[model samples]
Target: MAQLAAARQGTHSTKTRAEVSGGGRKPYKQKGTGRARQGSIRAPQFTGGGVVHGPKPRDYSQRTPKKMKAGALRGALSDRAREGRIHVVSELVTGDVPSTKKAMAVISALSLEGKVLLVVGREETTSWLSLRNVPNTHVLSPDQLNTYDVLVSDQVLFTKAALETFTAGAPTGKSVKAVAAESEVEA
Candidate 1:
């Protein structure tokens, strides 16, 4: 919920009478001939007046407890896993450079449809570039994973390294470095 709220761009704004331009002087005298009281043209009653009770820019971020956030993520992943929507792949390779053909082949092999979330332990440029163009496919690092993305995706594909990172508990610098070292040895 916090992630979803933060995603919203609350940039809406409105100009008040003081902020509106070209309303420095009064339009007419206070006592008018068969006319209502007069004020600045920027008054709300005027046609070119400033907005009233208008929206303003604000931050929609919510402060969720760390435990609650962790629990929610675990629950989401558990639900998906129970539903058999989580697939753990041995590895996601696309040669030394990114290749759309290789990425497409992998997607086809997995038979992934709709929204697919591919989680990786590290930021591999080749993998990211290769899968970026695939429709309905999103490649994200394990640390970037959240309950919203997990729940929204039709299928969640976790690379072996990513699975290990999750199973090892919260991601830390030491753990990430260890994972990288392991991948290097394997490669």
Candidate 2:
């Protein structure tokens, strides 16, 4: 997944002499006046000629196994949980419309500092809207959740429904009740 994020593609390219335009006719005949022979203007020896041994586009992405990616996600979750940096709320936003004030209030209430990753369920549009406007807070659907977001955030906040969806798919993981309990104990 991380590799997908950073394919960091190499796009450098230069046309080869054969591919360069205006090179069909020979620049000078083989038995020419005393001057170096040039097959065409596009030949490497000529000015404005094509390059040799130039770089072309390439993919730097590596194939990572599904199990490895899953394990990485689990590891990120476990680290945050161990530190008690995870929080869950019954609801993300109370109002029907987008409200930055309400979103700020939630963060203040949770006393979360630094970058925060708020995982909301698919149906929680208002919650996403309200919170996304707040700086330093990132809103994500449970399906969009990944190890990068989990590891980067100072605190991970999830609505109840989103929490269920996140942990439900993990293997050898804590129950929601246990998660909440563990968070409280550490906090």
> lDDT per residue, candidate 2, 120-170, as tens digits?
998988887787668898999876787888888999988888877755564
Task: Give the whole-model CA lDDT for all candidates, comma-separated.
Answer: 0.75, 0.77
Model 2: pairs clashing at backbone N, Cα or C within 3 Å: none
Candidate 1 scores a C-alpha RMSD against the true structure in Å of 5.5
Model 1, span 68-155: residue lDDT tens: 7777877777777677778877767746878878767877798978899998767566777788778898889877888888889998
TM-score computed on alpha carbons, candidate 2: 0.77
Candidate 1 segments whose C-alpha is farther than 4 A from its true place: 171-187
Task: State candidate 1's TM-score.
Answer: 0.82
* Model 1: lDDT of residue 50: 89
* Each prediction's TM-score versus the true structure: 0.82, 0.77
Q: Could you tell me which 10 consecutive residues in candidate 1 have the lowest summed lDDT?
A: 178-187
Winning candidate number (lDDT): 2
